[model samples]
Target chain A: MEIVKKVVIAGHFGVGKTSLVSRFVHQKFSDQYLTTIGVKIDKKVIELEGATVKMMLWDIAGESSAMKIPKKYLAGAHGLFYVFDLSREETYRNLDTDLFELNKSLNGNPAIVLGNKSDLVEETFIEKLHSSIATDFKITSAKSGENVEEAFLQLAKEML
Target chain B: MNLNEIKFRPLEKKTQVIVFDQKGKVLETDNTLVEVNPEGVNIFEDTILCGMEEQFLSLKKGEQVELDCIHTDFFGKESHYDFVVMRLEEENPSYGLVIYDFGAQYNQLFDLQQERNMAQIQSHRLERENKELVDEKTTIERLYNEMKDDSSSSQYILVKADSLLYNLDFKEILYLEAYGDYIKVHTENKVYVTHNTMKRVEEILPANRFFRVHRSFIVQLSKIENIEQMSLLIRGKDKVIPIGKSYKSILLQKMDQL
Candidate 1:
C-alpha cells in the first residue's frame, strides 16, 4: 500500500504557519500567539483533480534559535510550503535565504510560497519578490484565509 | 541521523591475488547453474576469498583438491587498488579457463558487486520487518487510547452534591447545568436533573482535558470548539459554556498548551 502524502510548512518564526493550519482545520481564529516547539503535525482531506488526498501537514519549527534542521522531517515529504510574514518587510527580505536552505535540504524538491497576514498588508509582496523565488510558489495571506487553499492545490498538481 | 550522511562509495578499479587450498576436503565442481560471484570467491586453507568457498561446497564432503585462481585487475587505466581471487570447485567444461580474458574477469567482478548489493538489500528487508514487529504493541496501544477517548460510551447517572455515584460513563453525558437542589444530567437525547453540585461532577470526570467553565456549569473539553473570553461555544449548537473567573487561568492554559 502507498503511504499518505506529507506537505511541510517551513518559514521564519511567527510567520503564522501554524495559524494557516488552524484556519483550515478549526475554521476559527485565536489571536493569542505562541511559539511552536520542534514540530506540529495536522491532517486535512483535500479533493484534488480526481483523488481524495489525505494531506498530512508537518509544521516545522520556525524559531531562529540556531537549532539544527531536522532531516527525518523532510524525508518522505512530497511538497514544501515556504511561508513569509508579509506584514514585516524584514521577514519578506529573508525569503531568499529560506529558499536557499530549503533547496539544499530537499535536493530540488518542489515548493509553494505563502505571504501570511495579507489582511494587514496593502499589496501582494509576493509579486515584488517573485524573481528571487520560483514564480509558482509565492502567494498571499492568513487573516482572511485568502489564497490558502490555492497554495496546497498547486502543490497537489505538481506532486500528483 | 540524516540519510545524506550515509556515504556511498563510487566504483573504482583494483588488482587481486590468488591462492590454493589443500587438505582432506570434499570439493566438487558442479555445473548446475549455481549463482555465485568471482570476486567473493574463497581460497582453501583460509587463503582465498569467501566466494571461492562455495566451490568447495560443490566438492565431495571429504575429497582433497587444488583450487584455481587469478590476480584481481583494474577496469580502467586510471584505476587503482588490487585483489587476489581463487576458486576450489572444478572448472565447468562448458566455460573452461576464460579467466585469461580481461573483459571476462571484469564481468565477473561486476557480478560480484551485484551479489553484494543483493545481500545488503535482503538484510535491509529483515531489519524493517523486525522494527515493524517491535512497534506493533506501541502502535496498538496508541490506537486503543484514541478510540477510548472518543467512544464516550459509558452510561452516566447524575446525583446530588450530597451524594456521588461510582458507576458513570461521563462521556455519554454531553453537559451538566445545575439548578436549585437539582443538577441536570444531559445525555445524548434527554436531560435529567439531579440534586448535585457541579464540583461533585467535576471530581468524577477527567480533569485537565475536561473543564468547569461556568459557576454552575461543567463542560467536556473535547466538546468546546470556541471561547470568547468567559463564554465557550460548545459543540452541536449555538450554546455557550460560561467560564468562572477562577477557572479562567486553567482553561487558558489548556487552550495554549495544545
Candidate 2:
C-alpha cells in the first residue's frame, strides 16, 4: 500500500530552508532570496520497496524562535528537517536553543539537522561546527544540490 | 529555586532537580522547574505514577527508576522531561528526582502523528472520488452495449411512405436515393419512398448491414452484384452507383477479405 507522509522544513531566516526544499522537490536553485511568507506546501512521491511513499512537504517561513512559528502550519507533520546556514555563525550559534524550543513546540518528533550553504564555507570550519553540536548533521549546499536527497531519504527511512 | 536563571546557563550546566512524595506530588524543586506555581500541583498527570499508586508504594527500599512525562503550560506549550527517580530515606520527601528536558523530541512525534492523520484523510477522499467516476463510466458503457445488441437483432423494419406503410426486409433493399427531403429505398420487387433525409435513413439502419458509399446513396452490402474501380453494380439493377472519394476507403474496408 502507498502511504503519505507529511514532512516539515524549518529553520532560521535566510538559512536556506526554502532553498533546500526547492532543490529537493524541483531540482533547481536560485541565488535570489525569496522569503517565504507563511508556508508553502509541495508534494513528491518516493518509490519504496513494494510500497510508495507520497510526501507532503510543508516549507514554513523561517523564524529565530519556535514560538513565532505558526503551530497550525506544523500540524500533521510526520518528520522534520531543521536546516541552518553554514556560512553564518549566528545561525549555527542558535541551533541548540532553537532546536530545544522546536522540540518543546513539536512534542519531540523525529528530525534531521542540516547545515546548508556548505558550498560557501570551508570544510574544516563546517566539521568543527558539526562536532560542537551534539546531533548528527548533514552538510548540504542547496545551490550545488549536495546531500539534499540523502537528508530527505534518511528522514524517510527513519519514518518507515 | 529560580529556573529562569538556569534557563540561560550553558548547556552542560543546565540541570534540574525535583523532590516529590511517593504519590508524585511536587514537594520541592531546584533550578530545573519549567513553571513557577505557588499552588504546588501534582507533577504526575495521566502518566508517570498517577494511575500506579500501588506500584510506587510497593517499591523496594533502594529502588531507582527513570520515567518520562509531558507538562503543558497555561499558554498551551507542552514540554517533555525525562526523570531518574530514587527512593529517599533521609529526606522529608520519599522520592528524589533528576530531570532531563526532552520537549523537542516529543514535539516531533506529536507532529508526525498529526501529519499521518491528514494524509489518510486526503487519500480516502481521492479514493472515493475515483470510485464514483468508475461507477458512472460503467453505467454508461453498459447502456451503450445493450442498445447495440437490440439494433443488431432488428433485421426488418416498417417504411412509412406518405399515408401508406410498406413492410420491407432490410436485407432485400438494394440502396437508398436522396431526393430533396425524401429517401427512395430501391428493392428488387418494388420501390419505397419515405419523407426523410438520407442522414436520418442512415441513423435507423443497422451500421453493419448498410454502407453509405456516396452523398446520395446508402447501399446494402449483400445486394452488391460487383464492385468496380470507383463504382458498384446492384444485383438486378441496371444503373451503377458512384462511390464518393471520402467514403471509398470505408467501402473498400468493408469488402476486405478475412
Which candidate achieves the best lDDT against the true structure? 2
Candidate of highest DockQ: 2
**lDDT score for candidate 1 against the true structure:** 0.56
Q: Tens-digit lDDT track for model 1 on B1-258?
A: 111111122312221222233332312222122222344443332221221334434444224333222222212221112221223235421111111223445446546544654454356557767777889978998998777666545435444433544344666656778887677766666666666677777786666456777778887777777888778876776777778999888878877655
Best by TM-score: 2
**Candidate 2 chain B weakest lDDT stretch, 10 residues:** B69-78
| CAPRI band for model 1 | incorrect
TM-score of chain B of each: 0.36, 0.56
Q: Write the per-residue lDDT of candidate 2 for residues B1-258, one digit (tens) a residue.
A: 223432343533334665567667766666444553425566443223332344455555568665543332211333555556666654443665566666666667646644653454356557767887999999999998788767665667889986888888776788999988888989888788889988888998988789899999999988888888899999877879999999989888987565
**Candidate 1: TM-score?**
0.36
Complex DockQ per candidate: 0.01, 0.02
Over 4 Å off, model 2: A1-160, B1-27, B30-120, B155-158, B167-172, B179-181, B203-209, B221-228, B232-240, B252-257
| Interface RMSD, model 2, angstroms | 17.8
Model 1 regions more than 4 Å off: A1-3, A65-68, A124-137, B1-258
lDDT on C-alpha atoms for all candidate structures? 0.56, 0.71
